[model samples]
Target: MAGAEDAGERADRFLAARFDGVSRSRIKGLIEGGAVTVDGATLSDPSLRVKAGQTFAIVVPEPEPAEPEAQDIRLAVVYEDEEVIVVDKPAGMVVHPAPGNPDRTLVNALLAHCGASLRGIGGVRRPGIVHRIDKDTSGLLVAAKSEPALTGLQRQFADHSARRSYLAVVWGVPNPLAGEIEGDIGRHPVDRQRMAIVARGGRPALTRYRTIRRVGSRASLLECRLATGRTHQIRVHLAARGHPLVGDPVYGRTRGARNAGADAAARAALAGFSRQALHAATLGFSHPITGKWLEFESPLPEDMGTLLARLELI
Candidate 1:
C-alpha cells in the first residue's frame, strides 16, 4: 500500500495533517502512548515513515477533569472589565497548572478572582488563557472572563494581529540598531526539553528587535516584537543570533561567561541576576466583544531595573 504522494512522510506529520485542530506534539504523544495504530498494528514511533495507502487509526481518550483549587494570591491587576482581565505577571509564576506546578499559578489566582465567570472559556485546566509567557519571563497577559472575549482574543492571536513587545537585557549589542530575525523553530532533535532553529519541518517564526540602550559595551537592552507567537520565540531567536539574554540559564551560560571586561559591580550584578532579563513590556489587541483597540504596558521589575543601573554605573 504505497502511494507515491504519502510515502516518506513522517508518521506524526501525516497524522497531524489529517487530524484537524490537533497539534503535532499531541499526535506524537498519542503515538507514544499506544493510542495510534497502523494497519491494526500498534505503532509507537512518531518518526516512522508513512507508506501511502496504509490505514492509520487513532484513539483519542476523553480529557481528564481539571480540578484545580482556588487560592488567595495577589495579582498585579492592570485592567479589568466584564469581558477580560489584564495582569502584569511577575517572573517565576507559571501561567497554568502543570505536573510539577499544580497550584499557585495565575489560573488559581484567576479562579479566585473571576469566580464562575471564567468557566467554559479555555476549558477546565487553562480557563481564559489566551496566550502565555515563559515562567521565567515576566510581563503583561490578558485572560478572558467570557466566551466571546476568549474566542475574539484567540482569533487575533491566531491571525498574528495581536501586538506583543518585550524588553530584554542581552549579552552583546546587535550590529544593526534594529532588524528582524526569521527562522524555522522546532523541537531540538536530541534534547526534547529545548527548542532549536531547524532547517525544515518547523514552524516559521519572526522577531523584530531594536537596541534600547547599551550597557557599557558589555550588555544591551533590546526591545523585541513578536510577529509569530511560538514557544520561547524571543529567547531562541536572540540566542541563535549569539546575543543570549542575561541570566538565561537555558541559553546564556557560555555567552554570559564571556562578559569579562565589566567592573566588579557590573559583574556582581550580572551574577546575582536570577532569571532571564526578559519582560513582556507591551501588549495590544482589539477588544473581542466591543471591537475596541486596547493596549497595556509594564515597566521593568525592580530586580532587572537595579541590574541595569549597576551595568550603567560600571
Candidate 2:
C-alpha cells in the first residue's frame, strides 16, 4: 500500500488487497498472531494506519503434516456406540485438519478418544468422516467408526436423506417469513475463499427456512433446514435474500446492518458477536448398521443465547 489514498486504511484491509485471494480475517490473524512487520518494526495491530512509504512483511508458516496427530482435546460426546459417535461440537473448533489448522481438530480429538477403533479412511487421515458443519458453527456431528458405518452414512448424505437444521439470528426478517431458497452454490468467481450463488457449473442447493421470532423488523430468528448440503449454502442463500446472518464474517455485509444497529445496545451486541450467529440445532439420520433412525438436538450455545436475549429476539 504505497499511495496517499492508502495511508489511512486499516493494515489488514490493505494487506488483504495486496495478498490476492487471502481473506481479511486471515490477514488480521497474521497481523495479530502470525508475525507481521512494518518498515522493519514489529506491528501487531491490525488497525494500524500505514504510512505511504512503509514496507510491510509477514512470516508465513509452513503447512503441517497431512496426517493429524492424536490430541487429548476435550469433546462433547452426545452419543457413541461401537459403530458410530455423535458429538456436540463447540464453536471455534475446525472439523478436520486443513491448511491453516493441522491439529487439535475434531478429527484429532476423535482419534485420541476412539483409539484404534477409528481407523484411517481409505489411507486418508480423515477417518469415519461423513459430513461437516462450518468451523465456527456450533452443532452436532456424527462420525462413523467402522467401514460399514462410513459407507452407509456417506450414502445417506449423497442421497440427501440425512437431516440437518440450523438456527440463525439474521439482520432482518425475511420477506415471506417462510420459504425455500434454492440456488447453485460454488466458489465465488473472484473471491475464491468464499462460496456464492452461481448460475453455471455449480451444484444445486436448497434451504427451507421459517422465521421463528422477530425483533420488530430489525432482525429475526430463523430455522433453516438443508435439503442439499453445499459449502456455505445457508449463508449464501440468506445473504442473497438480503437477510444475512448476524455476525457472519462472510456473506453477512449489507446496508441494512445500519438499521439493525440503530440502537446503541443493539450495535454493541451486533458488533461484539465475533462468529456467525448460527447453531446446528438438530441432526437426524439412520444408524448405518442397525438400520435404526437416530436424531439429536442441541440448544443454542451460551454466546448465541445471550446475543438473542440482548437483541430481544429470544
Candidate 3:
C-alpha cells in the first residue's frame, strides 16, 4: 500500500523507493514487461500516478536460464582460489552478455571453466559478475565462486573499500599533474547513449589521477585511482577536464583534431592506435572467506606498450 507521501508519485518511482536494492530503471523494465499489477489489474505504464492507500502487487518471475553458451575461449587467469577467480581480461571482450553481444563473453568463459561451481553465484545470466569494465578497456577483474564470496565482494565494492586503478594515455598532460576529479555523472541529456557530468540528479563520482610519464607535450601516461565506480568514470572525467584519452572514439574527436599540429611521427602513432589507451593495471581486495588482503597487477597490453614506445621515439 502506498502511504500518503507517495500519493501522485509515478508508479515506477514509487515502487523503486519502496523496494530496496532495486533500481528505478529495473522497476520500469519490469512494469513494461507486464510483471506488475495494481488492484489485481496489470499496469504497464511506468509513469502512472499512485493514489494514497492504493494496493499494488508485483510478480517476480522465476529467473530465466542464462542463454549464453559456454565455449572454449582463452582467459588470462591471474589468481584463483576456492572463493574467487581473478583474470586479466583482454581488450575487446564484453564482460557479460547483452542485447547485441549474447555470447563469447567473460561470463560464458567462466561458465566453462568453473562449471557447476558458478551455478548460483550472481544470477542466471550474470553468474559471478560483481563489477565490470568497458569492452575496450583491458584490466584485472575478480569473480566470485561462491555465494559468500559474491556477497562479501559486493559489500566491499559498495563501501568503496576495494582499490581499483588504471593506466591511461591522454592527449595532453594535465597542468597540475596530480589531482582529483569530482562530479555528478548521469546519462547525457542530448546523446542518451553516452554518460556526462550532469548539473543535477546524477550520481557522485570521484577519480584521482597523476601523471606517470610525459610524451614530449603531445601526450601523457597517467595512473588513475577510482573512489567511486560509476560507469565510464575515468573516461568521462578525463574528457570533461579537456584531456580525453587517445583513441577514445566517443570522447576523443575534439582532442584528436586538436592534436593535428603534432609532428608526423606522433600523428602516425595516434592514427595506428585502434582502441582507447586504457588498461586496468591493478586491483586489491580482501579474500571473501580467508579475511586476508590480496592484490594483483597486470602490465600494459602489447598494443598500448607499442604505442608508448612509438610516442617516446617521436
Candidate 4:
C-alpha cells in the first residue's frame, strides 16, 4: 500500500485505506492475528504507529488451486455453450471447497469436463461459478466460461435480475396462499453452524412463495422465489414463519414425527425426507454473449417426487 506512513497513523487505518475490499475491523483482526508486520517484526497491535520508511508486510495466504483434481463423478448436464454451462447438480454434491471436503466438488467436475476451457474463474479451484446452492439442494446452476460472461452473470445476480425459483415441502401450510418474507440474516449468536433472522446487524434477505398444494394437516408444497439470496435463506425464512420444511433436520422437524404423535404412516412419509425438502426448480437469465433470454427448469428429485405422489395432488 503506502510505502511508509506518518508515525501517528494507526496500522489498521493505514491498511484499510490501501486495500479495496478490506474493512477496518478485518484489518484489525489481521494485525492482531500476526498477519501484519512492521519493519519485518510481526505487530499484533492495530493502533501501533508506523514511522517513515518502515517496511510493512501482510502475509496473505497463497491462492488455492483453481482446478481441483477431477473425479469420475457423474454430472447431469442440462445445458452448455461456448460461453456458459448449466448443470443439474444432484443432492449431496458439494459445490466448492471447505474444511473436510477440499475436493470432489461440482467445480472439480466442471474443471474436468471443461478442462482448459475454464481459465480465469478465481483460478484452478473455482471456475466460472457465479453463485452456489447448498450441498443438499438439488438444482440447476449456471457457470461462466469467459471473463465477460462471468462479469455479466455476476451483475445479474447482484442486481437480483436473475430469476431463481425453488420447490419445498414444509412442515405446516402457510395461512396465506402466497407471501413474502423479508429480514436481515446473520450468523447465529449461539451456534456458528446456523444462521438467524436477526435485526441489529445482518444482511437483508427476501423470499417469496406460493402454495402449490396442501398436504394433509401438517405440510404444504410450495414454490419459492428468492429476491435476495443468503445462506439458508429459504429454510430460515420458512422456519421463521413457523413453517419449516418437513425433512429439514437443520431447520425443520427433528427426532421423527412419531415422537410428536404422528401415525406410523405419516412418520414413514416424514422419514422419507432425510434432507431439507428443497430444490432449485427454475433458473432464468439473459445470456451474457448472445443477449438471448434463457430459462431452465428441473423437476422434483426422486424422493420428493415419491413423497408428493403419496400426498396426491388430485
- Pick the lDDT winner: 3
Per-model TM-score on C-alpha atoms: 0.77, 0.79, 0.77, 0.76
lDDT of 4 by residue, 82-194 (tens): 78999998988899765446678997788778766765655433467898999988899999987888999999999999999999987666878899999999987755468
Query: For model 1, what is the C-alpha lDDT against the true structure?
Result: 0.85
Candidate 4: give its CA RMSD in angstroms.
Answer: 8.9
List the candidates ranked by TM-score, beginning with the highest: 2, 3, 1, 4
Which candidate achieves the best TM-score against the true structure?
2
Q: 47-110 in candidate 2: lDDT tens per residue? A: 8877798888878776566578889999999999988999999999999886567678999999
Candidate 1 lDDT tens digits, 1-314: 43679899999998999899999999998887788999999886899898878989999877644577888899999998888899999999999886457689998899888776664654553357899999989999999887778899999999989899999988877888899999999987865567888897889999999998898657899999999998888888998998988888787756443653345765677766789899999999999999999999899899999888877765
lDDT of 4 at 204: 95
Better of 1 and 3 by lDDT: 3
The ten-residue window of minimal lDDT in model 4 covers 253-262
Pairs of residues clashing in candidate 3: none
Better of 1 and 4 by lDDT: 1
State how far residue 291 of model 1 sits from its true place (Å). 0.5
lDDT tens digits, residues 48-118, model 3? 89999889888765555546787789999999877799999999999987644667899889888877666
Question: Of models 1 and 4, which has the larger TM-score?
Answer: 1
Off by over 4 Å in 1: 1-65, 122-126, 255-266
